[model samples]
Target chain A: MSGEMYIPTYQDMLDAHERIKPYIRETPVRTSAYLNELSGAELFFKCENFQEPGAFKVRGASNAVFGLDEEQAKKGVATHSSGNHASCLSYAAMKRGIPCNVVMPRTAPQAKKDTVKRYGGNITECDPSTSSREETFAKVQAETGGDFVHPYNDPRVIAGQGTCAREFMEQTGGLDMVVAPIGGGGMISGTCLTLSHQAPETQIIAAEPEQADDAYRSFKAGHIIADDAPKTIADGLLVPLKDLTWHFVSNHVTDILTASEEEIIDAMKLTWKHLRIVMEASSSVPLATILKNKDRFAGKRVGIIITGGNVDLDKLPWLK
Target chain B: MSGEMYIPTYQDMLDAHERIKPYIRETPVRTSAYLNELSGAELFFKCENFQEPGAFKVRGASNAVFGLDEEQAKKGVATHSSGNHASCLSYAAMKRGIPCNVVMPRTAPQAKKDTVKRYGGNITECDPSTSSREETFAKVQAETGGDFVHPYNDPRVIAGQGTCAREFMEQTGGLDMVVAPIGGGGMISGTCLTLSHQAPETQIIAAEPEQADDAYRSFKAGHIIADDAPKTIADGLLVPLKDLTWHFVSNHVTDILTASEEEIIDAMKLTWKHLRIVMEASSSVPLATILKNKDRFAGKRVGIIITGGNVDLDKLPWLK
Candidate 1:
């Protein structure tokens, strides 16, 4: 599956949406008058956080697991993720009655690990570094003889992620622009994939934490950039963009923006206070960028994809 | 308006629904599979907390504000509340381009006061005690000539709150029982008012904090039990039931259950962690009682009213 990179087309996304519909929630879209007033934009939040697995990655994970042919289903699926993707994949696999193996950083939040285990995913821990994660994942895949489902790089996963944009477009009618946090670029790439076909006039923006700005740097430099172990409180977004995600990011994303750690935390707390929903810090990057760049978004109908809500309640960033 | 006790009828509730339709949100009902598995009950959460003013009170507040005649509308509306009602009333009045006067205990959470002010409500501070609040409110009302809208006791307000149950029944098709926290008994009374007419077979259960269980005592003693100042982490349920609310509680309520402060806090955090919604501790009482009396709700369809989401994020009860 990794030899030659295949870009997921709009048809693949449409098919993925139909395949994953039974397994995923077409989560509700939420709006905050306070946030709209503050940003001077009509903001619509596609609440993927409210998904049963508490993340949008479930859309992609379910697509990958259910799309498996009967023969390939016997091998099950495997992936390495710092948080949501691992648990989401396990959830999808469990629903399909297939074994799921996850290689996770030892330092991943205990809450995340608990969720993965709850979904019956077998966990093999690796060091927190990227090199250690890749090396450990390779060994696990070989030993388990599992089908590798890369967290964000696989065409199946990206196509699955694109389903969110399809729902967002239907729910909001149309939007001037869509903003999403870019980690490994799975969500953003998916947004680009669907919107490029369905709402070509709509601009796509990728938000990144300044502390881990590989995606933002790549967009500006006109090439892919890899960050080994960038540090940020938005743990879900530390990975570098791969070739498949880069294909969409490079072509369809109109802009890449970065926000400070402090701004991201502030935006997160503000959402919890006003929007009244618990969401991860990584999801806050888009709001932080919008707040910082109000003129760019003001008076426009904006769609912000809230990626996930799986946070360790005891270890909230602001509490420290 | 206070001379003879007026009972709100089912027709009044139907009328209130139409009056408030443009101003209030028909909040979505949320379900948690994890919670359903734990309680052995199919629980449907009518998320009133997602209301724009962050409370179910907006339904009643909007009804009262919009039902006014031209001369009465000029006078505007007033209410004395410890928290949510003050802000909600202010929000409703602001929408109609009318004045909203609020009599609030100076001791109310600053977050609540800020919300009231943000909605352009004129606030008159009073002492924390019930007597002081009423005394101050009388003077303020006399001076301003504002129409008094009781937090939970008025027929107009009860009729307005009844609309929630109407939507709940429509949303869930039907439920075996409906549970809500008993504060001034406004919400519970409203539930009884609607269900007695719409779905008479559905049981109405009221949950109360044991520390401030005046409603529970009142239910047992067959009379009103007023507690001047009761202490509990659930600040919303401290008020005693008034005559209009007492009428419904005595006739229609199946039971009044109480939960310990610790149990309420635990349920609040559990909902936050699993349901991923920011809600007030007051809203957790229903879940607390449901957990304690699992056998009563087991295998039955239960509707839980999430009363409000106006909390001081800086001082979450569990964190303290």
Candidate 2:
């Protein structure tokens, strides 16, 4: 179900960029000769994994937390998340000296919960169900009188995410194509928003896991199609497309490509080996897609967003 | 056992920097707030792990390969190394389209041998003993008529390595202290050479694994103390210092520090956790020493040389 929200403008993204510049890192873009030889494409990786909270989610989270007026900020912000967004929001809120409440499923990994708690987030656990999460979140927000910050569907969050691509363009000058993993479509929508306005000649490519290929189907059907509980190693991309994200994804996206779980993990390991950097499985989807579809990207200067680096060290898939 | 050689001057380092600029990566200097807070100092990691051949060794190897005269170049280059130097020399030679002969120990890790072969180096395995290795290397050089390029002992290699610290100074402006792991004293000697000439006000600190603390003992004894077979997880730092390396180490180093095996591994894991980059166990010695000697480094801007990222993935220490 696509949630209805005001479409963020180019000016909104610019404002978000200015607002969040001080709090976030201007993460470096890295390249690897071995990776280029493998794909036959010159690739530049925008390493958001180097962000303080260890993910690009901090960009949007910081923008949302900082954009709140003094009165609203005092009430603080709340969200229902069990991933990087939860930790990033808590980190941003803590930095702003405001309270943050997160509604997480009780079954969420302890490592995820610990990260949120480490950032001073107050956790309110619900059963692993959408109804339970919504009911618990509503009560928590009511008790705290906090503003709800939807992870991807909110205009402010999407606008905040848009700044990443803006920075990418400035850093690399320009790229022939930009690729990013599509989860709830926050990062992808942000890419579309920025590139469509700033660099329309640059194509936007969304990568998805085969097990959770709703975005691919949705693109083909010309509408939003989302899976509720698709299981994949890319845990961050389990969420489906919402209307705010769908608006950008359907219109601006060049294509949605898919890769098998094995391919995704292989790409993740290869990235760790060649890039000499740690990145999560979800972030590897773009590389997986690029390797699988070399004809499309070969000889092109491609920019890939390494969305995050929040994998549980003990549970690295290769180790298993 | 130390062999005498002409000491390289400051101009040698400058020449090396200019010579290897195109062949090597001017790897980025990265910082982490968490790491800085832990050490109570601002730390800049000069990431040589990002080098094309995955180590700072490429700096020296490229210089040696490219500095050869037309006739000497036709003869090619040869060295006996079981670590980063072997692969780096091969990579540099491959780039220059010259024959590279690496005389590796028969007991050297298969992964290392594979890397040398991947770069088109002819591998000649010798018995894992000093006399055996040297004799084998001599025979190989005689048969191939290749110019000898010692891993760390040669003045050419030392001059080449000094380029890393020179770049670090230019990249970070200047630092109060510079730290690097000391094995055969190649990287540390280079650091001392560059910092002493360019940033004379900066202190040069040498870090060594306690299990292989010959350099530490040598500093205190005021004479080179060679270690025959000291064992350490930092495999890259097992080589003993020769007269050429000893000259720089003894003359310019501010202090030599040693870290326990446990401490080195912990720092390595912590770096990977915070810096979000892969680095070898040898590279983590600087951070380990900083953590141990916080009083000396507190509040200072310190540059740490992450010497390499060449680790056997299947045998990651933490996994064991």
Candidate 3:
């Protein structure tokens, strides 16, 4: 495997911004005095939860699929997931009229599967574990001759993820800090890469839910930590840091912070209450961090990348 | 009572828009292929849920409060509501550094009271079922010598509501149909007024929940209907339609449509899921109608006014 930065340069992000212009939405840069006062920070929300596929995964997946050559495209695209990435890839492939095969964990919630099916993806469910999903995906890719798109740890994927940060920085000039929840390093790594160059003054913050703090631990240890066992309301943040994402984040990101389960739930409700933006627990990572570390961010210009809105209602902890 | 068109002219709406520009948000227009496809309509959601005080009611409240003379401003403004309008009036008054009084039903959600208090408004509560919140508001006004701003039946308020349609049509050219939820009929009447004169080609739809079908009954009768009991999941739509709002709706609005409780819940959830914006049951009314009457809207451009996001999470049906 290539040890080099998987993502292309800032110039590539600029180019992707143009290439995906026809497809990706330039989501709103939202602000409020109410939120500002609560956080003690001047906040700008780069609402990727409002993105076309209801997640930033679309940005990377769309770019990867569309950037492919006709010969490669004819092979179609394949992935392994049962979350936003699967649906995003499925939707993006369907948009280009390419067949999509997704190998999902058998234990993946039905909501995610239903959404993927809505976009006409063929789903193969295996054992509820990474080894099984990966093995099934490899077999499927071999069977269909489909191009495999990694969820976060690929060059094309990271390049696409960087586009969100590039657009965000352009929308709100010179942010003092940028915050986002870290699951795998796909979002924050690309975010770090983009903000490191475009708005060099901006500090990058990786927010992680405490119940699933693999990234936080990895940052502290200066190495990658792949979490095999996980339990959290934020299902999206359950994935541990991968090698490429680890390298990307270690070089570009400045700090990582954690929020407790209670904090995650509170922040989720707060986002719903104030912004009218319904987000899953993973999306609340920023709000949870901000609320927990108010002193660190007071009076600074902050931008939060809300990742997605795909939440399982039955699993919502606040349904009391 | 003035037997007149409360919001009599388009200019009033324009003036209100300009006056409230500093405080009120010109909320974004959200478009979702998923929503448009589901409803069988090309939809542009004018998101007033992001507006100041979390509702369109702020526009009128801001206009009325800011337009007052110095002596009148010193006396301040007062209103009665169990929901959005109370917060809207309080917020507008606070922005002008004026004292605001809100008389609400004691049964008003604790969330609304908390927000009003947070904004520093004086509150008076009375029985909502057995007694009139309006009569209490009048008493509060009489004692305080403040001007009474009727929730929806006021001229300045209707003018404020009209601004939504003005911005909607301005942002996206000539909508084929404009749909808004009707409670006291302020939003529909004002939106219809703007559409009738400015974009005459556009048809107006008033979305009313089946449980509270006053607007539907009024439309069928070809005259204003009042002196009736009201009930609905859309709490904001329970108030009887006023005479002034009736006249405007009768003349300009094409029809009134009703949605079931399940439709309202699903539509509300869909709006939050797709738009990532919070909307109350009242705010969901227009979306509910589109989903209910899918045949009329296929392939046609339509505008849906998301009225407000002032919902109490503690009172959420999902919690139950």
TM-score of each: 0.98, 0.97, 0.97
- Residues B32-73 of candidate 2 have per-residue lDDT tens digits of 888988999999999999997899999989989999999989
lDDT of 2 at B17: 86
The all-Cα superposition gives candidate 3 an RMSD in Å to the true structure of: 1.7
TM-score of chain A of each: 0.96, 0.98, 0.96
Per-residue lDDT of A1-320 in model 1, one digit per residue for the tens? 44687989999999999999988888999998989999999999999999999999999999899999988888899998867889999999999999899998898778778899999999999998769988999999998888998889999999999999999999999999999999999999999999999899999999999999999889899999888679999988988998889889999999999999999999999998888999999999999999999999989999999999987777778888
lDDT of 1 at A199: 94
lDDT of 1 at A146: 83
| Residues B69-183, model 1: lDDT tens digits | 9898998998888678899999999999999999988887777788899999999999877699889999988988899988888888999999999999999999999999998
Tens digit of lDDT per residue, candidate 2, span A14-76? 999999999999999999888999999999999999998889999889999999999999999
Instruction: List, residue by residue over A1-320, the lDDT tens digit for candidate 3.
Output: 55565447877777777777787898898887788888999999888888767898999898888988999898899998878999999989989989889998888888889989999899999998668877888899999998989898887788889998888877897788999999998999788778887777789999998888888888888888767687888889888777778877899888999999889899888877887777778888888899888999999999999899776554557865
TM-score of 1: 0.98
lDDT-wise, the better of 2 and 3 is 2
Ranking of all candidate structures by their TM-score, best first: 1, 2, 3
Lowest summed lDDT across 10 adjacent residues in model 1 chain A is found at: A1-10
Model 2: CA > 4 A from native = A1-4, B1-4
> CA lDDT of A109 in candidate 1?
77
After superposition, which runs of candidate 1 have C-alpha atoms over 4 Å from their true positions?
Answer: A1-3, A129-132, B1-3
How many Å off is the CA of B271 in candidate 3? 2.4
